[model samples]
Target: MNQLRYSLFVLLGACSYGLHSSLVKLTTNAGYQAEQATGAQYFFGLLLLLVVVLFTKRVKLNMKQIGSLLGLGILLSLTGVFYATSIEQLSASMAIVLLFQFTWIGIVIESIYLRTFPSNLKLISIVFLWGGTLLAGGLVSGHMDWMSETKGLVFGFLAAVTFALFIFFSGKAGKGVPTIQRSLIITAGGFLTVLLFVPPTFIVDGTLTGGLWKYGLLVGLFGVVLPVILFAIGTPHIDSGTATIVGAAELPAAILSAMLILGEQITPEQATGVLLILIGIVVPQWRSKKATHPKKVYMN
Candidate 1:
């Protein structure tokens, strides 16, 4: 029953994250420059998180902690830049499929650092994920444009790398710290990093007519605030491997949102790919359960 609750929380987190990508695409498509939108979102998210921190009466930050928080914020800023740029270059579905590669990257990092091997079930899950990626991404499609596809693929991979780094570093920074304070610091860092690049003209022109503030607020809530809150709450209850697999739900959500909201069509092969991805995600968790509850020993 506890596990069940954790699973639901993880699912909710994934759904929030999935919706975030689509909302970001909408704001970008609405003529807001990626930098402006990203900057505003982070800035606003920082404010929102600050409010939460104040309301909850979290721990006060020391000087050294402030420095670490600033560093984390910068990493998050880079993450936003890469992610937003990738979305502009690639369709959200393809971009998300690529970003989800962080799952494998995270596993490899854990295996290396912890000197542990993934279970056989996890190895199979990796295969399913890759196969599904190929199918969903139309790599098998004969008419693929190698150059454009390659660029998108490269950016997507970069996003995955950065995202993995963000997760790793954030976890490190948040150790012995409250989640709200950690979130605040990271958001502030991201806000500062983006501020360096966002021009004065963008701020001067701010209005609903310009669409920056509206979409910025949307991305702040959906992309930044909500996912952070959900994941922070959910991760403590589940193992990392299970949490990672469940998070893959974001990919399918991106694909479906692209189809319905952006009018991107999925070919039959892509549909099959989606199914494989879902299977891959589910298989690992199911296998984990089986391994943990092997057949009872028969007593004499």
Candidate 2:
């Protein structure tokens, strides 16, 4: 039951994350720069979580906890910067497929930490994931925009790496901290990290006045606030393998949002690829009936 609850929490987190790109695309199309959107995202997200923290009781944090949350916050900022740039440079669908590379990357990280190779199932899933990626990326459709594609791939892969690190360390660190408290501290760290990337003039200038808060609220809630809190609450309860596997839920959600909301075209091939990837994701969690029970024999 606890497992089911946590899984649900993870799925909710994925759904929130999936919607992120679509909303970001909307904000960017509305004439917001990536830096502006990103800066606003973390800034507003910090404020929102700060409010939540104030409402809740406070817990004392030691230096170790402070350092861990701050480091994770830095990675979170990298994920946002790289990912939002990828979305701006490429179609949202393609950017999402590339970012989903975190699937295999997470498996590799897990193997390194545990000093073991990936299971046959995980390796197989990786094959399917990449296969889906090729189709979902519109490369097979001969729609390659190399100028944008090159930049997108670079940033998208960076997003994947940073995001995988965020998941790995977030799960392992700050286990003793309260979920909301941890979320707030990490968001504060993210806010500070983001401030470093954008120029001082950008934040201090009048740019924040023009309907920025509306988009900021969306990205802050879905992109930063909910996912951070949900993952923090749930990831610690499961192994990183399962946590990353469940994180793939963001893939289909992103693709569908791009197609439906952004009006990006998805071919039949890409649809099939999405199905295959879903199969790969589910295979790891499947428990075989035969493995669960065995027949008993009695001899006279």
Candidate 3:
């Protein structure tokens, strides 16, 4: 029952994350620049988190822990910045596919850090991942948009890298802190990074007119607050392999959200590619044999 509950939590977390792409697109369409949107997200995200922390829990972190958490925060902020910029350059669907590349990138980073090669299952998944990326990206179908694709590829890959680092470091840091408290500190770190990248004038001007608040709150709710809290709580309960498979839910969620909310086109080839990617994510984590009966056997 506990496992089931955690699985559901992770699923919800993925869905929340999936909603982020469309939300970011919406914010941009509402006339906010990418930096403006990203900055607002972090700024308001921190404010929301601060309120949560003060009312529910007080975070107490040592200097070393603060340093590690802040490092993770920088990576998190970079993901927001890069992903928002990427989606601005390309369709939400395409940008999301590129960002989802972080899954395999995380695997590679893990392998290198552990000084070990990927498992055969992971290698097989890698094949499907790259193939799906090509098909979903429209590269295989010769439907590429040269100019936007170039910019999207650059920022999307950067987002992927930063996302991988965020995952890696978040796991390593603040092992002993309570979940909510740790989340607050990490959010503060991201807020700092956002302030560094986005000019104060952009954030100030956006806030003064009250135009950016709705989008800021939206991004804050979906992108940072809800997903972070869900993942922080649920991920600790699941093993790495199962967690990885479950996390793949974000890809399809993002794709579907783009199709439904943003009216983006999803070709049959892209659908097939998405299926392949999902299959790759699941195959390695699947159990090869059924559970054996403990006390009874059927007669042949």
Candidate 4:
């Protein structure tokens, strides 16, 4: 039952995150600049998180942790900017594939930091992930423009690096702090980081109009508040490695949502690539399960 609950949590979290990129795409198409949309999402997210913190009595911030949280927020904001910008240049499906490269980045970084090597399963999965991404992005689908491809590739890699940094720093900041408080601090950092770009005429120009506010509020509630709350509640009960793998589901979810909801087409090659990536993700879990239960003896 606990396992079932955890699986549900993971599924919900992945779906929320997956749907978020589509929302960003929609808002951007609806005449909101990338900066404005991103900024509004985080700002409203922070506001919602604060309200939760207040009601839940989880408002506590250690001064000592402030520096780390601030730094993390700045990094995350940059990550958001790069990702949002990439969405403008690349298809949501392609952009998501690139962004999910953070899984490999995280594994490499952790391995180096711990002075250890990745397990055989992890190594194989990493290889499969890159290969799958290339196929999924339709890199082989006829000639590509050198400049556009180069830019997309660079931005994609940058997105991965920055995302990995966000995860690393979030983990660091989360320690010794209540989950809600930690999330609030990080959200605050993201908000302030975006606040720096809030134009002087933001108020006078009526950029934050009623409709924008409504959409922004919705984005904040679903994209930020709900995911954070769900992940926080769920992660404690799940193994970190398993959680990370489960989270990868967001990649395909984003891609499929874009295809179905936004009318994006999925090429045959890309579909095959998606299947490879899924295999890559599943194989590791399968191996781990086998290793854990070496013999499946019948139970009476």
Candidate 5:
């Protein structure tokens, strides 16, 4: 029951991420630039995190540790930025499917870092993952126009790549810091990263008052603040491989959001793709037959 509760937290965190692309699309439709929404997301998210952090007791860290956390924050921010840009060209559901590539990408990262090949189980998972990706991406339903959507494809893939890196490092960075405090610092770094590409004029350009703050608040709450907080509570208790499977909730949440919020259609093929992807994520994590020495087969 305790493990189930922690898994729920991680599940909710991933579901929160699924809301972001749809929100970004809505904000874009309201005449806000995608980049502006990214900025506002981090801006408002950082402010909320700071509020929570202020009431908590403080712990000090040296510059090196701070830098490491900040770097991780930058990677987190890039995932959002790239996903937003990808949604600019693709349907919200499709963009999210691309971002879900993070699953297999993470395994690859683990393999390289561990200096060992992924076990046959994970290799099989990659095949299922790509097969589902192709179907879910609308390639088989004949709606596949991304042959012309090069930039969107690239950005979407980048979102996956960066998110995978973030997941990889999150285990190692800020190991002993309080969760909220670490999240606050990371959000601060993310806010600064967004500012680098998008000017901070929203601070004064009447945009916040001009109704931009509403979108910012929404995006910030769901996209950054809640997910980070929940993951901080949840991820530590779950193993990496299981967490990856639990994170698969994000895709279904995204598809639902795109359908209900963005009013995007989910074709039969895409639905099948989602199923396969989930299968890919779940099946690999099962203890393999040679499980006497589990490290020999990393489902992670």
Candidate 6:
């Protein structure tokens, strides 16, 4: 039951992450640029997390711990930039398909780091996840163009790599720190990363007073604050490979969010893909349960 609870936390976090694209589209429609959207997200995300940390229990950490968490946050910021830029150069479907590569990449990285191979069950789940990604991303329906520029492909895959790293490391970094404080520091790191690349003109410009702050607050709440706190609470309890597979929840959630928020239509193929992704998530958890409680044999 505890493990199930941890998995639920991670699942909810991934679903919160899936809310990001739709929010970005809505913000864009309101005349906000992509960079500004990202900048506001991290900025307000850091602020909200800071407030949460002050109200929660806090802890002290060494320089190494702080540095590691900041590095993890940098990976987070990098993934957003790369994934968003990829969508600009390629079809949204294609960019998503490429970004979804994080699932396998994460598993491989975990295996390499731990000097162990993935279980056969996990490998099978990977197969199902890849198939679902293709379908859910619209590749199977011929909605994607294969002729995207090399930069877009590179950016998409880079996004995948950084995101995979973040999933793998978030569990391991600052292991003793309080979850909210850990999240706050990570958000601060990410906000700093955004500042390096973005002007933060949203701060002094009429952008915030002009109503971009509304989008910023919403984006920070869903995209940054909730996910980080949930992942901080959940990831340490789950293995990196399984954690990556579980995070595939975001793909289906993203599709559903688009349908409801943007009034986009979902096709039969996409629905089936979402179903398969759910099955893939179930596959490992089911195996975990069986492993924990094997059937007893009756001697005749």
Q: List the RMSD of every prediction in angstroms.
A: 3.4, 3.3, 4.0, 3.8, 5.1, 1.7
Best by TM-score: 6
Q: Report the lDDT tens digits of candidate 6 across residue range 169-197.
A: 98899998999989988888888988988
Off by over 4 Å in 1: 1-4, 62-72, 86-97, 142-155, 207-210, 236-241, 287-300
**In model 4, which regions exceed 4 Å deviation?**
1-14, 87-97, 145-154, 198-204, 230-245, 287-300
Q: Per-model C-alpha lDDT, please?
A: 0.70, 0.80, 0.74, 0.68, 0.79, 0.90
Backbone collision tally, model 1 = 2
Residue 185's lDDT in candidate 2: 84
Task: Residues 1-300, candidate 3: write the lDDT tens digits.
Answer: 465566557667777888886898899898777777777787788889878777775556789988987787888888888987887788765676678778788787777778787778777877776777666656676755646568788999899888767765655677777777788878888888888778867555546257888888888888888877776777666544345545666776777788999998889987987787677656654432122223586999
lDDT of 2 by residue, 136-227 (tens): 65567667665656888899999999988888887888888988889988988898888878763545677777688899889899888999
Q: Name every residue pair that clashes in candidate 5.
A: none
Q: After superposing candidate 3, which stretches have Cα over 4 Å from the reference?
A: 1-11, 84-98, 143-155, 206-209, 237-246, 287-300
Pick by lDDT: which candidate is best? 6
The worst-scoring run of ten residues by lDDT in candidate 2 lies at: 285-294
Clashing pairs in 3: none
Q: Assess candidate 3 and give its TM-score to the true structure.
A: 0.81
Q: In lDDT terms, how accurate is model 2?
A: 0.80
Per-candidate TM equals 0.81, 0.86, 0.81, 0.81, 0.83, 0.96
Cα lDDT tens digits for candidate 1, 1-300? 465566566667677767776777787798766666666777668778988888764776787777876786686567667766676777755666678788788667657756889888777878887788778867666354436866777877787776665544544455566777766776777777887767545656654346677787778887777766666566666556566666666667667777887788988988888898888777766754666677988998
lDDT of 5 by residue, 1-300 (tens): 455667678778888987876897799899988778888899899999989998986699989879988987899889888987898898865686788788878887777778887778777777777788777766665565668789999999999898877766766678778988988888888888888778989779998889999999999999889888777677666555456556766776777799999898988888998888778766654553234344654686
Off by over 4 Å in 6: 143-147, 294-300
